[model samples]
Target chain A: MPARVIVVTSGKGGVGKTTSTANIAAALAKFGKKVVAVDADVGLRNLDVIMGLENRVVFNFIDVIEKTCKLSQALVKDKRVPGLYLLPAAQTRTKDAVNPQQMIELCEELKPDFDFILLDCPAGIEGGFKNAAAGADEALVVTTPEIPAVRDADRIIGMLESMGKSPIRLIINRLRPNMVQDGDMLAKDDILDVLSIDLIGVVPEDEGVIRATNNGEPMTMTLDSPAAHAYLNIAERLLGNDVPLMDLESYTSRGFFSWIKKLFKRRTRQY
Target chain B: MDFLRKLFGGGNDGSGAKAKDRLRIVLIHDRTDISPELLDSLREEIVSVLSKYMEIDNDKIEIDLDRDEKAVALVANIPVLRIKRGNVDYDKV
Candidate 1:
């Protein structure tokens, strides 16, 4: 079978769409599946940076679309993962430079050799989002456990369903288990109730994610990081394995250990 | 504001709570492509039509619109003006 084009999108901004794209792609690649991560942000490209492949980009997604370079030429092979590659978005061109038909054609051409193609979509239901979703076989609606994000996601899911897309899944990102336990935040079940879609994964709020993202390293590269393990489990589930979800509460420190973490945080200034 | 109140229980809206509420109402209407002004006009027209046909207690009348299960409805509770007063005057009959 050819690659399944999964566009990771959220209608609202700052909901970890790019991070999920990078991490999910990395996870799939690490599992020995051929995956190509495409940055579809165009003018405001961030996936390249998230994947830490910005410095090596000689060509971009626009180059492939414009025929300035072949699809093979635009793909930047990952340094650590053998089967992974990234086709980065263009920085100099606006979204109007590409069309939905071209994106569909590009994905069609790239499907044969890869097992999964993850498109990191830009926020909003604009031209760029349309182009990104045009080629997708399935959609991973990334949303935070917040009202605004969930509402926007509901709108997006409705639109996708109206467009006759099927198997649209949800990934709740940046979930704070402590807040959920304390009744200060919404949980995974609450989100699913609103969207009423199949839940694919839930990622905990991990500070290591921030540390890794700042260093332009994908959190998935850190195998033991809770977020990484959760993402890897999500990838396995995506690949037809019915892996259980991660338990973030187990990772929470208590008693003496909790006191030590607080003391350490007090000693180190937060960035 | 209602949605934030419903979701976050009014958290994260302290500084711009009013603005966020306004935006939420506006966005909900905008995305649904429905206008509150249009609804108000519809209500006014319906109430006017009701008043023209019969004597109605306008103060106590309530003509409202609602969305239930993606369905639209006009719900009215109009009080009829009594033709006779004084507890139906049973003895006078």
Candidate 2:
């Protein structure tokens, strides 16, 4: 069977597009499925670093597209996971170095060998975003619970719909539960109300993500924190497992209040 | 201080509720590609056209662009006091 090409994108930068791609790909690989994390963010490639395969990148995405290297040669295998690979993006070349059609063709060549092909898209609705999205069968939009992020995400969803991409799912990242309860940050319900898309996962704000990135490790590998478990659950859901969304109260001070809110929500849905 | 503010339920300056309201307005404008001035003009035109047939409460009239996942529409709620029937004061009759 052909691999499922999934592009992880967020129009706004620093919203965890690359991180989600890396962690989810790693989690999938850990489940013994063949996965490739393609860094489509040319000139700003961090997917390789996050997967701890930076030092092994002899050839990059542009190299494969330009026909300078075979696609297999460019795929840097992860020592940490059995079936994970990293197709690093060129750090020196700009986004225009490759086009959308070329990306589609590259994924076509990779489809037969891998079980999943994850594209780590660059921020902004530009050449990089076009190139990343051109080849994917599905889109996983990563967003933070902020006004600008949600607005950009809504725009991205609209664009993806116009392009006729089906099953576009959302991953809400960096949610500060404490702030959410305090009415200082947008809650999960608020983001869903605005974006109006099927949600795949929600990762709570955790400093462990930063630490894992600095160490060139995917947080899911250690599964040490709340965010790690969230990423793993996302992987499970992507694999067609019906994993329930995590309870936000566990990360908040007003647990009983949030529980009451949940009970009220359930009761309202019964009607 | 936080507890006092919570108890009194007043110091919600720059809160998430305010942010949601702001985003709602901005997203509607962005999706419809309509400016605030354009919306104002549209409202004025609608009011003028409706006034030709009936006495309308312009101040009470509500006009907004509502959107969902599938469609967007202009929803207007104009209060009508009486219908003007070809130079006849129907309300007085």
The candidate that wins on lDDT is 2
- Stretches off by above 4 angstroms in model 1 are A254-271, B1-93
Root-mean-square deviation of every model: 9.4, 9.5
Model 2 spans with C-alpha error above 4 angstroms: A253-271, B1-5, B8-14, B34-93
Q: Which candidate is the best by TM-score?
A: 2
What is candidate 2's lDDT per residue for A1-271, written digit by digit as tens?
A: 9999999999999999988999999999988899999999999988988877778889997988888989889989888789989999999999989989999999999999999999999999988999999999899999998989999999899988888887899999999886776677888988889889999999999999999989999998889989999999999999999999988767765577865775565356334
Candidate 1, residues A1-271, lDDT tens digits: the string is 9999999999999999999999999999988999999999999999988888889999998998888998889999998888989999999999999999999999999999899999999999989999999989899999897778887898888878876667899999998876665355777876775467999999998887888778888878767688888888889989989998888877766578776664464345222
Scoring only the A-chain of each prediction against the true A-chain gives TM-scores of: 0.93, 0.92
Q: Return the clash pairs for model 1, or none.
A: B1-B21
Q: How high is each candidate's TM-score?
A: 0.75, 0.78
Question: Per-residue lDDT for B9-78 in model 2, tens only?
Answer: 4564537888888788778867897678998999999888888888998789888887774457888899
Error of 1 at A210 (Å): 1.4
How many Å off is the CA of A66 in candidate 2? 1.5
